[model samples]
Target: MGGSGWRKAIRGFNLCVYSPLAAEGGGDVGPPGASYDPPAALSPPDPPALQLPTPTQSSSGLRPRVSASGSGLSKRTCAICLTTMTPGQGHAIFTAECSHSFHFHCITSCVKFGNHVCPVCRAKWKEIPFHVSSDSPRARSRVNPVNMNRRHAHMSFQHPLLHNLEPCIFNDDETLDTTFKTSGVCYNGSINTVEIKTYPEYSAIPESISTDNFTILIHLKAPLGPRNEISSKNVYVDAEDSRTHRAPVDIVTVLDVSGSMSGMKLALLKQAMGFVIQNLGPLDRLSVIAFSSTARRLFPLSRMSEFGRQEAFQAVNSLTTSGGTNITEGLRKGAKVIEERKEKNPVCSIILLSDGQDTYLLSPTLHNGQHTQPDYRSLVPSSIRDRTVHNVPVHVFGFGSDHDSISMHSISETSGGTFSFIEGEGAIQDAFAQCIGGLLSVVVQEMQVRLECLHHNVQLGCIKSGRYASWVTDGRRSGTIDAGDLYADEERDYLVSVNVPPDHHETHLLRVSCVYSDPVTKEVINPAAVELKISRPELVGSQTMSIEVDRQRNRLQAAEAMAEARASAEHGELSEAVRLLEDCRKRIFESEAAKSGDQLCASLDAELKEMQARMVDRQHYEAMGRAYVLSGLSSHLCQRATTRGDSTNSGSFTQTYQTPSMVDMLQRSQTFSPATRQSNSKMRHTLSFPARPKPR
Candidate 1:
């Protein structure tokens, strides 16, 4: 009668008994009338089908729902109701910027009944789209167009918001026309080597742009890692990967043996050329050409074998300076050498070093009190251009203060190459080293990006791709951007301003795809295209934006200021140039990225200050200031970091500043070893040479 007695009785009731025939070792027992027969073994029953976890009923008396996957299993749970959310089951899912997700109804109910914060994370709720019937008879409107414009303008200039809306940026009349002419500026140099990765700034756009337009910034980056500042091993590479192998280079070095490059300059030039030859590998090819009154190929393109390099050194050492400077002839000879390359698909480029202006190629005269700049592009043959000449970049170096910087910069820009100012005797070697470093580290070639608008209502306002050509087709619905060769891990950004209409409601806005060739494999790769989609709601909260987009936009604006300042300085408008630089500095400080302690913004700010100081008056502006400003502007516009110098002494030049180009920072930051690091360091100190200013 105790607990133990009850347990024993329950065990007896649950016990199982075998059949008599089975216990007696007989086969099986059939029906009573049938004879005994062997029985077959019984198989196990099938497992139960998978089912989604059904959420429990809520305290608020809401019915529990089960969210199911393909396997009919629930993966997500709603925090508010303690219920599973069914995706695509007429129940909307709201994802916050913090990446927390909840059922739309649950979150909205919570927000309405509770505080305006996420129930799960307690973070401020964001990006909740709303639909309201505005302009209804019962609805009171309090909208001000003028106030909206002012707010938009503030957001546009203070941060990387809608770039086109800022009047200070475009300085143009507002027009409803959507057609935009692509303004291309060379960010770096042209086509030659590796795989490039591309991605969009944001995954989604807010539905309503009735008050302000949306801007999309797409980034094309080389997968190069951050550089080791103290080491020469700058580019990060997986040795196991074939794509990272240095591409074979075919370079034509054009030197100026003009009368101006006589003593220290000539000696330094020879040394720089020798250094260039030493760095080249057996797979690389080199050629040398010298021009003064005429151009002559001192050395033809030959493999950089030990013996071949010896011959190159001899040719460089035997260089002599005389006669008038003939830059046009030098470039022509260099182009001719490139055309005669023996290597197939090698990284081809031209290095032009000049110390003086071409005596025959004169600067245009002022007409009607306006400075008529000479057409430097017309001075060079079509074959020398990047478009015509197999994308050969012509990297030009101005050796002295008197060297025609405008013409040199133009030639480099037109050819999709970079322009460097080499004033110091020792600086040329350093400049050459940096240039060659970038050349050898190329990984991607002939890169191009295409942006296609998915909706007809969505229009591309403009594409700000530094130095590369971009054009909108299909009546501005689609656009193709030419992104020149990127070095290992070098990133290029394209700020695309899109005009989205209010009536348009689509999930997908644009498609971005890139086509690039790998120099190592000699294979063209077109990766799967990425789509840009944003939900369209009648109204939405301020969405979280990409900091990278903001940073790139800020860079573009700073570069624009540099360009404007350079033009003002060129036309003898010193005060205007200074004003522009000051304005740029103010914007840089006000930028969100800058306030967040972005290093690039700080560098740009310092550069603007330096530029403003350089162009304070006409006397300094004409002396060495014009070339200094041009060099800075060129570096910024081209996105190619260059060492700029001014002659403090007639016998030698001293470097004044170096432009911190994004490409140079990303591509060649680790290029300078301790031995070669002196070049960049010594550039900071101003040396007193008591030199005479070169004639304008």
Candidate 2:
């Protein structure tokens, strides 16, 4: 049948199947028969008795297995296979730079499969020419074919083929089935086995793995996914080396003193401030600003060494909440303080504590002159409206649910600072401590990731950042180059992840470059010409894992859009509501394409499509209703104007007046109307008015 015929048949099947009872029976006929009587009891059968298997003792009366060495005892387990091993076995086991390790045989098998290193450690080994050495231990230990197969069966019986044999030896149990097996061996000769029905415990290596006698695994898991192996040994030692420079920072603390910020909220803010002050080193300088309708500097900026502890404590304790919230004023004053201190201090930052909203500040006015009335309640001046223009950065900490997170995020984004949301008062100290610790360890002054795509045809999307700019690419047939700046002699590293179209044939190359200012010489340094090549895709099954991730992301997007539509409806934004709903429908459709097996996705696709059609119809009617109202209002306004002119006996009366319909249409089409032209003329005339009369 054709596609249309199949659809019709499916719809007909759905309609016929109304209820389970109706579908099960096609009309009743006769009454049910009587229940059958119990059959006469036959001679009672002999009771089946439980029989236990006789235990057979081995000739030696003990299992023959190698015991773990005393020094080999450890809690380290293979992360991949999750098996516990004795320290000796673990020590004998070789690990690559990537921290992956395995038994010698297992490593050999992995290498034979075009994997050049330990599957778990991901260590790359030098490719040496193959030559048979008579004295080689591996050659001497090679077993005959029969013995090799027997060993393989024994190993398979003791432990599943999936388990890694690096740190533990397996022993076979004749009583248990092939599926049931042991999982771990301890240094004290203790063994643990798990049944097939039980959940497997993943091996977690608590201690750092050693890098020796193994190869690193550099191949990532999948296209644009996380690298399969990273050498733990390659990570920088001496954690202190991560910091490049040490400069004293000048900090300004802006506290909210609104009525709402009383009691626990205010007390916690003070406690957190005290913790920060105590943690500061002698070189740092600090200032305090408290705000509520207006901002007041309670203390001037003072060096950590010279500041009196009594005075600082008094200033924090004396703070009280009153009046309305004026966050804009507080921020402006705090910025000024930072600027004044910038000439003396090399580093300056502002730490703002509040709920993340702008209730204290008025919404910005549009520049269009249609409305000439000015709202003097706005606290943010036109000069410093943008936070990016400021020299100092602002870090925000939100307390309680009442805080506006979007405004806080915007403040952080503009000032190139970090924004953190605190769920409760108890978490205030920890959050403040973490922020202050990060500030003390600040290494790179200005770090940024720059991507230079080799494939010009590919389009780049927006790069997002919290504390630093991290670049990720999302497109087909693209190569990415990530570069960043660092502080002088500051050893810094960034993880650059990029997305590219899955290629199955040709190799793709990504070029990277780095530029930074030298810390000692204070001169700019540039390093370029770093390139990486990605191999072609390897087809796995019917669906690529990337497709699954894409589908999941689409589902999340749909859910978010649905939530936003519901919120917009509550806020009386009908247009925005309808738009969000439409976006949700599109996302659902796109998700269908990524699902495995077209037949399985068919039913869900049909349901989603039907829902979308219904929503579109409803939106259409709603839009028409809105248009009708606008048109009626416009006609009424014009009629009123005409009537007024006629009553005045003006012969030159024209039927033209501003209405909601005209305004909406003009906004939609981005066109100017005759009314707007007249409004502009009036605005120019008003601006040209003579100077205000001098006061007597």
Candidate 3:
């Protein structure tokens, strides 16, 4: 009977307690009413067969106690109420260690009334702490204790639960914790958890979200790209469907007609201009400014609609070559033309083609200070001088060999324009096309980047934007404005090609931020933010991408450097040659680093290295040339001594054959040996006399 009663109690406990708990907690725990007391028959039938206490309704008219166990009556036992246990249905149960149970819902309400212990035994359940199981699901679901503590500290003043209820909530005081989740159990007693939901209040974004005045960002695609086979038919196909506001372009073509540019160079210039004119649409306008001794306008700000092909052809064909190169005057004239047309167009440009030489004016004044006469020739007029002063970009093209490329490059760089060199007449059209294409391709406008510092504790350093980019770094601490240092901040926006990462499909809003200092105020701004939306080009079917000439530009720059170094060496400017060579070396190094393929990079590296080695060899050759000349002079002097029969007259010979100190002898001791010197001496003795009138 005792064993049967024990079996019956165990069965009831398993069914009532373990099953309910396991079902309620998603199969993670056993049922609640698992404990049961032995039956009277099994316990010697003592104490009038003590029965488990039935649940009693409390003052709130709800069942409070449900079950009982040994040594204690069930606090409240209501089978009907207990059977209704379901999640979110208000029915709840809490079992004590003594196997006494009560309604969880009722108990919570009772505890709020300052009840610190179980009502039956007056035992403090709060103080009776239970160890959390390592593999328990509840323990696993709880927020990490350390993270919770950090979050609590992060929001010590504000309520954690309240803060997480909204979106777009900027935390002015929350500190990011870096050391919270290093190790140990996830949920200890120290952590707090904050639950954040999506923000519902931010309903609309303003069309112009920036708080500052309008800013413009012009993205210029790189002027060059890989050389691949492209079909000409696809070149004219429109790849983008969007219509951009095409700004009026004011262009001044400053052509070089110096004596050096006699035939092929001059003809190529004419042909390239023709190509440009043919490609211009009706809405576009053009201007032709030619320069020689003085600048002259062949055509000024004529719309393509009114521009006569015959007149343009006549103007170009009539160009004559004469005199010295005057680049400064040419640039000045181009700038003046654009300045005159600035009101007519927002975009103004100058296209200068030269051999890269500048000649100063010989006369002090002309027409009583109205004009000055140039010494040799002037391609650039004096009127364009103000453009450089005003920071206008000047695009320059160096044509043919014997051109002054260095000054032309300087002009382009100083003016924020591009510098290109045409190796031969054949490349002129291609170079012109690239320049024009770059000028025409403008899609984005009024672009600005705003940065907000998210991390305040870490000290930030100087931030570098992309090459040829600009940034703002000062003014009010939180608001956006125009007044700021150009190079002081990490947040910057400028014109640049958006290079899509591989396998990227959709456009994304990227917030690029970095910490930086304010140059004027010396305040550290953390996590400076520059927001940008990047999208892939909507390429159309069978469209031909325009060929970029950036690679060509780099190669051209490299070649130009080499040429400049040679010229410098020829002019006895060794230091200048070394400087130019070093620049060339650096460019080559960068090119190698930027190349995509190993084979191609290695090939280019080898070529550049060879060129560098050749440059060194050329310098050695120049040195050797000077030595050879000196050696010839020395040999001539020895022959003269033998002719005068002064073999022993070392003193007289020394005075007579004294050479200039400027001459340096070759350091070839082996070749100029004593034996060779003696042989030369004997030969001089045999042939020194003029054959005594041929023994007449």
Q: Between candidates 1 and 2, name the one with more favorable lDDT.
A: 1
Give the Å shift of residue 36 in candidate 1.
99
Worst 10 residues of 2 by lDDT: 4-13
Candidate 1: count the clashes. 11
- Model 3 RMSD, rounded to 1 decimal: 42.6
RMSD of each: 35.2, 35.2, 42.6
TM-score of each: 0.62, 0.39, 0.38
For candidate 1, what is the TM-score?
0.62
- Can you give the lDDT of residue 449 in candidate 2? 32
Tens-place lDDT per residue, model 2, 1-696, is 111010000010011000001101211111122111111100000111111111222455222121133111122432211233346643234455554443333333223222243322223567511332434454445231111222223332111112112112111101211121121100010011110110001111112221111111111110010010010111111332222233445788888878788655665465456545544543466777888877776555655431222224335544566677677888877766654442444456788887534555545455675534333323333323453434365667656556654455456545555455554454555455444543443323332334444533323343322134354544523323222222112122222233344344432334444443322233444434344443343432243233333433443344355445545644566567567656655555656444454331332233233323323444532322222222222222111111110112221111222222222222221111111112212321010111222232
Which candidate number maximizes lDDT?
Answer: 1
Off by over 4 Å in 2: 1-246, 306-310, 342-346, 355-360, 363-391, 404-406, 455-505, 517-529, 536-696
Candidate 3 wrong stretches, greater than 4 Å = 1-248, 361-391, 444-452, 458-460, 463-696
Decide which is better by lDDT, 1 or 3: 1
lDDT digits (tens) for residues 214-250 of candidate 1:
6787866664522321122211123332133446677
* TM-score of predicted structure 2: 0.39
Error of 3 at 329 (Å): 1.9
Q: Which prediction has more favorable TM-score, 2 or 3?
A: 2
